[model samples]
Target: MAALIEMREIVKIYPNGVVANDGVNFSVDRGEIHALVGENGAGKSTLMKILYGMERPTGGEILLDGQPVHFHSSNDAIAAGVGMVHQNFMLVPSFTVAENIVLGQEPLRNGLLDQAEALRVTRELSQQYGLRVEPEAVVDSINVGMRQRVEILKTLYRGAQVLILDEPTAVLTPQETQELFAAVRKLVDQGKTVIFITHKLREVKEISNRVTVMRSGKVMGVVQTEDATRESLARMMVGRDVFLQVNKPPVTRGKKVLEVHNLSYVSETGRTMLHNVSFNVYGGEVLGIAGVEGNGQTELAETLSGLRPAATGTASVNGKAILNTNPRTVRLSGVAHIPEDRLTNGLALTASIDENLIVDRYFRPPFHRGLFIDYKVVEKQSADLIQEYGIRTPNGKLPVKSLSGGNMQKVIVAREFTSDPALLIAAQPTRGIDVGATEFVRDQLVKQRTDGKAVLLISADLSEVMSLSDRIIVMYEGEITGVFPDAASVSEEELGLYMLGIKRQTKEEMEAVL
Candidate 1:
C-alpha cells in the first residue's frame, strides 16, 4: 500500500546561508504513530515546518496519498487534513475551551454565534476521541496539561486526519504523560496518523510504531520501534554512544546552605499561594523538588530567588537573610538561579553570546577595569565556557538567538554553573532540550554537589529528579506532600500519588524536610 504521506528530496536553505534540511525524505504509514527524533536544530523542526506549510521549502515535493501536493500556507495544510500543535499554546486567555476550540469555525444561528451548539459539538467530539476535557472551563484557569488536551481536541474537532505534536510531554508530569500516551494510542486506533517530534528516546520507544532519527539536516536512520534500543537510537540521534547515567560522588553532607523557615507567599490578588513551606539544602547535596506543573513550584522558586516576595516566612542563604531582597542581592550573596522559562528570564536573545555570558558579572572587578567594560576579557571567558560546556556555536560574537534550543540552554548552564555559586537553584534545567544535552546538564548538577555546593533541582520530569537527586520532595497544591529521605528508596508510582494529591506524608516526615 502507498504511504499516507511522503516528502521527496526536501531541501530548505535560509537567506543567511543556513541549510536547515538537505535532501531529506520522510514518510508515515496511515494510522500509525511515527516519531521524529533528533537533537535540537538537527532539522526535525525544520522538516516538520515544511510538512505543515509553516515554511516554503526551497525544494521538495509532498505526496499525500500518492499524489503530488503543494501547500502555500497553514490554511492549505489544514484544508488537506493536516494540523500542528506547537509547544506554546495559542488559545486566548479569556475564552472558554469550547469557544477556543471552535473559534474560526464557529456555528452560526441566524447571523449570531451559537454558544450552546459549540459546547455540544465540542463535548461530542471529545467523547468520541476519548480526549476528555471541561468544555466550559476558562482557558487561562486550566493547568498546562489540560490546556494541551484542549489543543489536541481542537485539532481533532477540525477534522484533522494527521496530527503533529512538538514535544508533547515537555511540561507534563509522569501521570499526565501516561494519559497523553493513552490518548495517542486512541487516536491511532481511530485511523488517525500522528507525527511526534521530540528529543526524548524513552517516549519514542514507548509510543511510536516506527522511529526516524535525523541529525545535521538529514535522516540518520529509520527502524521499527520493537527493534530499536535506547542506546542504538541515541547513537543515531547524536552520532555517539550517549551515556544517560550520572556517576554521583560519595555522600558528604556538610553545613546547611539554603534554609527556608516556614516560607509563605501570597499573590497580588491576596490569595495565599504557598503554604508554610519549609526545606533545607545542605552543602554537597542535591534536593530534588518534584511536583506537577502549577503546584506552587513556580511560586516557591520565585519566592526563594526573590523574584516574588514572601508573605510570611524567612529564608536565608548561607545563614544570611535573603527574604524580601531583590534578585541582585540574592545573587550577590552567592546564589545562582536557572529559571524554568529560559527565553523570558534567562538570556537576552538579541545580545551577543559573550555579552549575555557577562550580564551577571559585568560590574565585577575582573571584567570591569576603571569603569570601562573589557570586551577582550569577556570574549575570552565566553569562548572558554563555550568549549567547556559543549555549546555548539560558530563563535561567541554571534547573537544568542542564532543558536538552537539545546545550545542556548548550554550557554545558561555554563554561565550559572561556572559562577561557583554557593547555592544553585536549577528549575527544569533540561526541560525541552535533547537527550545528549539533558545528560550534560545532569552531569553538571551532579558535579556541583561533588564540589560541596548546595543544589535545589525543581523539575516536572520525574526521571530527571530520580536520577540526580540525593533526596526528593513532592509538592502538591502549594504544600510538600511527601519527603523521601533517600531518593532511591521511593518508587515513581508512590511519588506520583503524592503529586496527584492521592497520598500524603505524616507530620513527622514533613518536619524532617528541614
Candidate 2:
C-alpha cells in the first residue's frame, strides 16, 4: 500500500542547539496502526509535532498521499485531516461532554450554538464508536478512561482521517487498556490511520501492525511487529543488552520497621476515605499496595508518610509512633518517602540541584554546623549523590527545572535513598519515566530490600507489582480486599475483580494471609 504520510531527511534543530530530529526519515502506511517507540528526549514527539505542523522542521519535505504539502500551523494540518491527542487531556473541566466535543466547531443556528444538533451528533458518535459517554455529563465528573475516549471523539468529530495518540495507555488500568486497544482496532477497521507514540514495547507488540524505533533523534529502523521482539527493539534503541526480567532475590523478613494500625480518615465533608486500614512492613520486604487509582491509595501513602494527618489511627516507624508528625519528625524517626507527584511535592524546581539534594538533610550536623550551613560539605555531598544516582546533568549547580522528568525523579530517589532509613515509602516511584529509567529504579528498590530496609510500594501498574512485591495487598473502596503472599500467583484479572469491588474476600480468608 502507498504511504499516507512520508518525510524525507527531517532535521529539526532548536535555538538552544538541541537537535530534536536529525536526518530522520519516517512514513506511515494508510489505515494502519503504526507505533513510534523510543526513550524520553529521543525526538518522537518532535517528529509528531513536525507532522502536525506544531513545529516546522529546519530541513525536510513532507509528502501526503503522494502530493507535496506544507502546513503552516496546526489548523492547516487539521484542515488536511490530521489531529493529535496529547498525553494530557485538553478539556474544559466545567464543560459538558457534548460541549467539549464540539468546542471550536460548534454548530450554529442564527448566530447561536445549535445545542440540540451538538447533543445529537455527540450521541451518534458515541454510539457509533462504542464510547458510551453521557453527552450532558461534566468532563471532571468522568473517569480518566472515559475522558480519554472524549478526547479521541473530539478528533473524530473534527473529521480527521489520521489520529495521533501520545502515550494513551499510561494512565489506564489493565481493563481500560484492553478497551482502548479495542477502540484503536475499531478506528483502524473504519479506515483511520493511527500513529501511536509510546515507550512501552509491550503495547507496541500488542496493538501495532508495524514499529518504528528511534534513538538520539534518528530513525534506527522500522520492522513488522510480528518479526520484532522487545529484546530486539531495546537493543536497537539503547545499543545494549536489556534485562527484561527483574531479578528480585529472596528476602529475609526482619523486625517490623513500619506499622499502620486501624487508620481511619474522614474528609471535610464527613465522608470516610480510609476505613480502619492496617498493615505491617518488615525490614527487607516490599509490601505492594495494589488498587485502581483513587481507591484511597494516595491517601494511604500520604497518611503513612506523615504528609496527611490521620483522623484516627497510629503509624509507627521502628516502634516509634509518628502519627500527625511533620515530615522532619518522620524523617528523624527513620522514614523515607518518594511522593507520588514528583513535580509538586518531590522537588523544588526553582532551586539548584545541589540545594534540592540537601533540602531534607540541610539542618543536620554534617550539612550544618551550629547555626550555619557548611557550603563545602553540602556541595561535596550533593555532587557525590548526583553521580551515585546516575542523574544526567551537567553539574549540581544547575537548577532542577532544567533536568528532564526522569532525571528529576532520579534526584528525588537519590535524596530519599541516601538517607538509608529503616522504612521506605515509595509511591509510584517509576511513574512517567522511560523504561530504562524504570528498570533502574526497580533495581534500586530491590537493592534496598537486599540491604534489609522495609519498602512500602504503592503502584497502579499491575506488572510492576507482580514482578517486584513480596506481598500484595489489594485495596477496593478504601478497604483491603485481599492479601496475597506471592504476587506471581495471582492474575491481573483476579486483581482487577478485587480492585473494582466486583469481588470481596472474607475476614477469615484475609486473616490467613495477613
TM-score of each: 0.96, 0.94
lDDT leader: 1
Residue 151, candidate 1: Cα error in Å is 1.1
Query: What lDDT tens digits, residue by residue, belong to model 1 across residues 1-514?
Result: 9999999999999999999999999999999999999888789998998888899999989999999989998889988999999988889989999999999999999988799999999899888887778999999788788899999988887889999999898777777888999999999888999999877778988999999999999999889999999999999988989996778978789899999878898899887889999889999999999988888989998888879999998999888999899988999888999989899889999999999898889998789999699888998999899999998888999999998888889989998998889999999999878888988999889999999999999998888899899999899889988999899898887898898888998879678655
Model 1 gets an lDDT of 0.90
lDDT of each: 0.90, 0.89
Window of ten residues with lowest summed lDDT in model 2 = 264-273
- Residue 267's lDDT in candidate 1: 93
Best by TM-score: 1
Over 4 Å off, model 1: none
Candidate 2 lDDT tens digits, 1-514: 7699999999999998999999999999999999998877788999999999999999999999989889899998999999999988999999999999999999999999899999999999988877778899999778778889999999999988999999898767778888899988898888999999987788899999999999889999999999999999988877777887899988788998888888987777687889998889999999999887777889888887778889998889878999888888988999899999999889999999999999998998798899999989989998898888889998899999988788999999999998979999999999877777788899999999989999999987878888899999998778999899888889888887787777898988987877
How far residue 274's Cα lies from its native spot in candidate 2, in Å, is 3.2
